[model samples]
Target: MKKTAYFIIGLSLLFSLLHAQDFTYFEKEKNIWLQVYSNQLKAQALDSDIKALERSIKEAGTKKKIELNQLLQLQTSKKKILDELPQSFDTMLEKITVESVKDINLIEYLFTSQKGKFNIQTQRLKILKQEFDDAVAFLTKELATTESQENRDFFKEYQLKKALDFFENASGLLENKEEVLKRTKQSYMSELEAYKQTQLPIHIIKIAILFLIFLLFNLLKYFITKKIDNEDRLFRIKRVLNITFFLLILLMLIIFNISNIVYAATLIGVIAAAITISMKEYLQSMATWFHLSFGNSLKVGDRILIQTNNNQIIGEVINISLFQVTLYESINNTTALDLKRSGRTVFIPNNFFVTNYVYNYTHDRMKTIYDLLEFKIPFTCDTKRVEDLVTEVTLEATEKYMEIALKQFSSLRKRYDMRSREFRPRIHFIPDTKSSCFILYIWYAAPYHQIMELKSQLSQKIVKKLQENEIEFCSN
Candidate 1:
């Protein structure tokens, strides 16, 4: 009995050693995960601090410009560290995916204990991207607003340069992001396909039945719509249902987790944001177009004058678009008396609404303007006769046109929300210091297109009348 007991004890000891040897490899893997867990905890703490710093940077006022470089350096370092940590986790995950986990509990460990590590790292990266963008934008604004030359150079060198470089480096990850995502999706898809294999035949049969039913239903709907006269509406419905089917397929991919949907969506969003930032001028112009369109602000055929480059660009607004406004050139940099068209069309950006002041002459009706024109006469001549001659010649020239303007304005008031401003031909003889003559201020109101011609005619007629009346005029 003693010999039998020794033999049994020896056998039990041998079995224990062998069992330990079998699990020894997995035990080391678990230990490695433990070390990763510790690193993850430290990373999480660092991420929290980084977030705090980002908040402070955002809230920092203009006075904090000097400290921006230091803050950026620290932030960049933390982000770099955080960026480095993911490689370790990703390496482990790659092993997990590639290697067969013989022990079922190891898979559970990854889901439970290591899940936070994965999720937190992803969040850290996402937050870092947003923080970096915010910092860059903030520093740019600060640079523009800061009066200090020192601060401007500091921002350009340290803040903007570093931030842009970091962002560019981070985006480089996207170069292989597609490949990584493809592998991940394939790994998940392979698992899903294996799972589906068990009941694939049955599922296929069910799917075929449903597909036939859907096809039949669509055919019925098509026939019904075919009888209706609204072919366009029916065609649109068909397109919508087809798109729905496509979305349903994508939804199934997501449901199976074979799509790498999150990574793909995030990547596309980042790329899209980059594209949008690059094309901000176009987008802003489009937004401005929407604002103008909705506000019913400006329209074609409305005469407009915009002040630009210390010159008033007077033209008839020929065409209005999101990108540009086409203007038929009427009067240019010369004199207002230069009413002849230069035959040059002006293409003005829609963004002109902000920096340049737009003078829309014709809002809801035809363009009519009152030109304040001044002419000098000798102070020795009778002021009363000059005023009467001026008034009479102006009246003779514009009487019929003014009558028409009154009627047109009355009709325009009915059509649009406007009050009429009138200008009857009047000559005011004001005292002049430079010339020994009274200034004949002619307040002429007429159609915009005809104002130049009418003014010329009025001037000639008044001079002829003055010459007949023997009135002396002064020259500048």
Candidate 2:
């Protein structure tokens, strides 16, 4: 009860102090403050702002409930003006003069609390506010009527949205429109961004379609080429296509008529020359192929000896080409006996013909012979009989091999148009130690294989023939 009495005493003192200020100035200030604060509430989003405004009125203990309800309605009329608040702090403050206007009545009431002066200022502010409200209401009505007529005439949803955007933007300039203005501005930016994003897919689709056309053209060209067997016809077709495509590319590169065609053609010519020079070695190889084709140089089957790195390769000609030649080594063979000793082939450059000698055995002469002699007569034997026997055997062997060689030569001569009949096999006496007499020899058509056999056979026959002739031979 004592606390309640003290509160009542303080309230009475506050009321008396407010009354002593002439009440009129306080009344006008109270009305303007209430009007501006309530206008801020209405311009905000509907639900939160309404609840906030109710809470604010309840918290203002100086005002009665009935009086606050009336102020709320009066302030709603000023909501449009309050909603014109600028986004920028400076611009909004300048436009609304919120602080200045709030302090004006307070300062006037503090200086001279007069009922007449307070009423005049209050009436002026009310008139100004009413004019603004009336203009807003009239304009809104006119716009609504225009929209209704346009709806009757038929309006696109897109056009309506555009109009909504314009009106929302204009309404954002009001004194207390921050919340709604910010939301609407975000929506506008999002819509514009969506429109820009949609155009990107349009460009992507155009690129994809162009790529598809290019792939289709390449596939068509591949299939068409596969169907043709004649290389020349295909090459001609390719050349024409290449020329057409070249011109098309040129046209694309130089879209304007003022571009220099001659300069571009010159650049192309330079590139072609550089390519040709780069492939000069290949061209030289092609020339070698031409030489082989024209029957000027040795072909695949010609024998040759290539001196390389201080070593000699005597081999049969196996395979030949513009760039390389292959050989079957013939060094270890008498009658192609060691032909298999070396691997299948050894490749030699055709350009080797320019600096190396080629030897073709089959092409040169067929009656070639290599002869060797081995004597086994004893030291104690009659030297004369041995000499005669050796002579006779060697002569007989020579004659036998010569006969076979001449026959083979005649056959080859006829077929190859080669005069190999002049080749003859011969034998000569050679120096030997006292224990043996050697038969030096030249032979036709006999290889190292048959040389041993022929010597053995002749030795046996000479012994038999000399024995029948009573030839004395010494025993070893």
Candidate 3:
């Protein structure tokens, strides 16, 4: 009876040990199977996502389609990874089950390798998610700022919708990937926290410094230019300061942020090339404006005559800008017809300065130009008498202008080696044999704006003097 009881107890103990060993093996197999099942589900979801992205690409606009294709490539790559992971896990799981291996260290090693790969995937997904979030935010901002209903509708239907869809899909995938990583005894949140600790503060400092620099420069610009009274000079100075400010900021940004010189140079070169190509005409105009501003070739309130397409435009400069020069058309000796079009504004492109000739009537503030008065008289008339009368009338009409002109000419002479000339009124006569008459020419100095008025005064006086002297004028 004692031998029988001992045998039964030993048999029970042996059975219990066998059951415990089997249970341990089953638990490990079950966990791996669960991982396999989870990965398969993820792979199917990624495949569906890739297919959906391909379809969306077809329905999207040109730019949107390109973005969707990129998304599709990313999704396909992820599915490939998922597809590969399941095969690897299955092979390891199969080996464990078929070989009935009591130790599954090889499976653990495979899982460890897979965790590293999944971590890489997680990082990629994080970057993709950030890009999508930025795209969606940008689209939202554009939609809000767009005043046109047509534009708003287009953005909502196309850009915003596609961005939102991409964001949603990426977010779902990221969550699943993070969940997988958690099960592998790795947490993405810890890595993220480490990155924030290591890098985020530095970025924050850079941004804060950039903002402060921008503010300081703006304040300095305002303070320096606020006291200036000359509007034209102030505007030109402001433009120069603005260009300097932009270059300084750009240089500082490159210096502060870009560690790689090769990359920085390439980026700068590319940006410069794009701007030069896209804004060729405008840049030319701006460069010409710089020349005009510093060279003293043009200014506001100066009377100028520009010849364009065989037509003459005489006006007073009202404004000079980077792109164009504005003029207020006025009556002048060069273009008398401008009297009817007086007060009208004319805009000449700044780049026109390169190809066209501009005649500044009031150059160097001289404000005076020589004007001619011509009339015909019979050839039989006394030449001496006509000359004397014409000269007398011109001198009387332009008495005040002669002194001012002489002073201006003196100043101009100091600056340039000018040819000497008689500053006072002069009279000349040319016999017109075809018409049996002599042309009496009177030249006088007059203000640019008052040329017509001065001419009228001299003409009335000269004609009266000729009539009083019985000098018969030729009808032709």
Using alpha carbons, what is the TM-score of model 1?
0.44
lDDT of 2 by residue, 98-178 (tens): 111222222343353333433454454445445445434443554466567735522323333443444345443443434
Candidate 3 residues 17-125, lDDT tens each? 4433332321232344334434544555566566656655556667756766776787678777777676332243222111112222323333433445555655654
In model 1, the Cα lDDT at residue 168 comes to 57
Q: Return the TM-score for each candidate structure.
A: 0.44, 0.31, 0.46
Using lDDT as the measure, name the better of candidate 1 and candidate 3: 3
lDDT ranking, best first: 3, 1, 2
Q: How well does candidate 3 match the true structure, expressed as C-alpha RMSD?
A: 24.0
CA-RMSD of model 2: 27.9
What's the distance in Å from true for residue 372, model 2? Answer: 5.6
User: Which is the leading candidate under lDDT?
Assistant: 3
Cα RMSD of all models vs. native, in order, equals 25.4, 27.9, 24.0
Please name the candidate that would achieve the greatest TM-score relative to the true structure: 3
lDDT of 3: 0.68
**Clashes by residue pair, model 3:** none
